[model samples]
Target chain A: EAGVAQSPRYKIIEKRQSVAFWCNPISGHATLYWYQQILGQGPKLLIQFQNNGVVDDSQLPKDRFSAERLKGVDSTLKIQPAKLEDSAVYLCASSLVGGSEQYFGPGTRLTVT
Target chain B: QQPVQSPQAVILREGEDAVINCSSSKALYSVHWYRQKHGEAPVFLMILLKGGEQKGHEKISASFNEKKQQSSLYLTASQLSYSGTYFCGTEGAGSYQLTFGKGTKLSVIP
Candidate 1:
């Protein structure tokens, strides 16, 4: 079976610029998630989608970050006015269901200068 | 809240044994383990629920202690492929959100 897929394995943007990352989860997966991993740290949950609806996004910075999974199969995460602190890897994962094992994508490494 | 992992890093020769521990301050519903190589996505290891059941994958096994809100990963007779950063993700009671630990770096050499 194919695993989660993501685009632009690497990205570079200037501070205050906008950037977007894409994710296509495993087929038939019901739950999707977005996470941010800073250097030397574990991935932090940014948002979660259960099908086409969002289940959790409490940790996400609404002022700058946003994500959506319109069809429940693919999702996108966007960051506007990116800050230097936003330089990190953006990972996308999917699970058969909530609270189940998650399979992660290769991730998009964003470098904000 | 984020979980705490111990022995931030460890080095071992092949055929050795090592243990990585993870503890959470809040009540836990489940604990998930994953290993990630440099610049790679994390690979799922195993999940231990609140029942305190122990799960194993190959030479790697894990145990979850509900009473103590802690989990430990045991790697016995380690191989070179075992070298990576291990993370423990925890979910609180009645919640599905997983908060992860800083990670434990394990290096196995021949």
Candidate 2:
């Protein structure tokens, strides 16, 4: 079975620049999530989607970050006007409905200089 | 809120036993554990559901105490391959997304 897939395993951008990351979740998975992991820390939920609609984004930085799941199959997370602190890994994960385990992608390591 | 993990780091010799704890202020419906090596994605270890019971997977087992909203991961006869960061992701009783703890860094030495 294929796991969640993400694009651009690594990205480098300057402060004030914008960056986008993509994710293609495991087929038939009904839930998708985006998380940010700063160095030496655990993953923090940035947003969650149930199919094509967002279920939770309360922790997302509204002014600078946004995410969307299209057609309930793929998702994208964007960070605009990146900051030095944004130099962390962006992880994507997916799971079956009501399932306890989540499959994670390789993640995109974004370095904002 | 993110769960809290105790003993930010632990170093143990191979064959020794170590324990990592994860506690949350909110009521937890489930607790999921994972291990991630440097520069790698987290690999699922085990999941403890409600009922406040203990679940064992391989040489690693976990206990969930609903009354205290805490979970603990036990590594017995630790192996050199056990070196990595362990994270506990908790699903609150009323929440959908899993909120992960800071993590416990474990280093099993030879």
Candidate 3:
């Protein structure tokens, strides 16, 4: 079985520029999540979607970050006017249902200079 | 909120054993473990559900104590492959988010 897939494995952009990351979850998974992992730190939950409807985004930086899972299969996470601190690995994961072990993607490494 | 992990870092010789703990203030319904190599996405290790159940792969085990709202990852007779940063992600009751602990870096020297 194929695992979670993500595109643009590495990215480099200047501060104040816009960047977007894409993710394709595992087949048949219903819950998708976006997480930001900084250097030397664990991935921090940014948003979660249950069948295209957000289940939790309390930690998302609304002013600069946005994500959507259209049709509940593929998802995109965008950051406009990126800041230096936004330079981190953006990971996408998916699970079976309400509670299950998540499968992670290779992650898109964003470098905001 | 993020969970707290103990022994921020540990160094072990081959064939030794080590334990990493993760504690959360909020009641957890499930605890997930992952091992990440430097610059790579974390790989799923195991998940321990509530009711004090333990589940894991060969040589790597974990225990979840619902009463204590904590979980521990155990690596027995460690090998070089066990060297990496270990993180515990916990899902609280009624919440979909899986808050992760900072991490525990383990170095197993041969």
Candidate 4:
């Protein structure tokens, strides 16, 4: 079976610029998630979607970051006015159901200069 | 809240054994383990629920103690491929979100 898929394996943007990442989760998966992984740290949950509906996004910085999963299959995460601190890998994952084993994508390495 | 992992890093020769521990302050519903190589996404290792069950995958295994809110990952007769950062993610009761620990860096030298 195919695993989760993400676009632009790497990205670089200037500070204050906007950037967007895309993800297509495994077919038939019911839960999708977005995470930010910094160097030497574990992936931090940014948001979660359960069939196109948000399940949790408490850790997300609403002032600069936003994400949406349309049709419960494809999802996008956007960051506006990116900060240098936002330079990290953006990972997309999907699971058969909530609280189940997750499959992650290649991830987009975003570097804000 | 984020869980705490012990032994921030460990180096072992192939065929040796190693254990990584994770502890959470809040009541846990489940614990998930993953291994991530440099520049690669994390790969799911196993998941243990609130029943205090133990699960194994190949030479790697894990045990969850719901009462203590702690989990331990065991690698027996470790292989070179076991070199990676191990992360433990915890899920609280009635919550689907997973808060991951800082990770334990394990290096297996041949």
Candidate 5:
């Protein structure tokens, strides 16, 4: 079976510019999540969605970051007015349920100069 | 809060044993174990829920001590394939977010 798919494996943007990443989860998966992994650090949850509804996004930077899971099959995460600190890998994952193991995509490595 | 992982890195000889520990400040609802090889996505190892006993997946065994809010990953007779970074993600009480540890890098030399 195909695993989770993400677009634009790598991205480079300037500070104050905007960037967006996309994800196509595994077939039939019901839960999707977005995470940020800074260099040499473990991934931190940014947001989570169960189908078309968001399940959690408490850690996301509401002032600059936003995400949506439209139609429950694909999702997008956007960051506006990017900061230098936003230069990290954006990972996308999906699972059958909130309690199940997640399958991750290749991730979009964003470099904000 | 983020979990604390012990021995930021470890180097083990093939067939040797190793243990990685994770401790949390807040109460944990469940602890999940994942292993990620360099440049690859993390693969799930096991999960130990609150009030649940120790759990084992293949040769990789994990124990969740709710009283201490700590969990440990045990690799017995380690193999070269065990080389990777191991991260422990804790599901905090009443929270859906998974606060992951900094991760422990394990290098198993054959």
Candidate 6:
């Protein structure tokens, strides 16, 4: 079985520039999540979607960060004005409805210089 | 809030044993353990809920003290494959967000 999939495995952009990351969840999975993992730190939840609807995004930075799961299968996370601290790995994960064990993708390593 | 992980890092030879501890300030409902290698996403190891008590898989197991809001992961007869950074993700009563710790790096050498 295929695990979660993400595109643009690595990205490099200047600070203040905009960048976007894409994710394709595992087939039949109902929940998708985006997480930011800085160097030497664990991944932090950025957003979560349940069947095309947002279940949680309290930790997301509304001013610069946005994410959407339109068809409930594929999702995208965007950063309008990136920052130096935004240089980190962006991970996408999916799980069965209310399932605690999540399958993660390769992740997009964003480097904002 | 993020839980506190002790020792920050550990080093052991093959066939050795090590214990990693995680503690939270607030009451926890569940604790999830994951391991990540350099440049890779974290791999889920196990989850320990306050109610489930002690659980483990193979040589790796975890114990949770519900009253103390503490969890300890046990690694016995460590192997080179077990070398990685360990993180404890904690969940509260009714939140979806998982606040993860800084992580504890473990290196197993032969």
Stretches off by above 4 angstroms in model 5 are: none
Name every residue pair that clashes in candidate 3. Answer: none
Full ranking by DockQ: 4, 1, 3, 2, 6, 5
Regarding TM-score, does 1 or 3 come out ahead? 1
Tens digit of per-residue lDDT, candidate 4, span A1-113: 99899999999999999999999999999999999999999999999999999999999999999999998999999999899999999999999999999999999999999
Top candidate when judged by DockQ against the true structure: 4
Error of 5 at A53 (Å): 1.3
Candidate 5, pairs of clashing residues: none
Instruction: Write candidate 3's Cα lDDT for A57-104 as tens digits.
Output: 999999999999999999999999899999999999999985688889
Model 1 earns a TM-score of 0.99
DockQ for candidate 1, C-alpha atoms: 0.94
Chain A TM-score vs. truth, each candidate: 0.99, 0.97, 0.98, 0.99, 0.99, 0.97
Candidate 6 pairs with clashing backbones = none
Candidate 2 per-residue C-alpha lDDT over B7-96 given as tens digits, one digit per residue, 9 for 90 to 100: 899999999999999999988899999999999999999999889879886789999999999999999999999999999999977677
Worst 10 residues of 5 chain A by lDDT: A97-106
lDDT of 1 by residue, B8-44 (tens): 9999999999999999999999999999999899999
Model 4 misplaced regions, further than 4 Å: none
C-alpha lDDT score of every prediction, in listed order:
0.96, 0.92, 0.93, 0.97, 0.93, 0.91
Error of 2 at B10 (Å): 0.7
At residue A92, candidate 6 shows an lDDT of 97
What are the per-residue Cα lDDT tens digits for candidate 6 across A14-82? 999999999999899998999999888888999989899998999899999999998788999999999
Fraction of native Cα contacts kept in each candidate?
0.87, 0.72, 0.79, 0.95, 0.56, 0.67
CAPRI quality of model 5 = medium
TM-score of model 2 (CA atoms):
0.97
lDDT of 4 at B88: 100
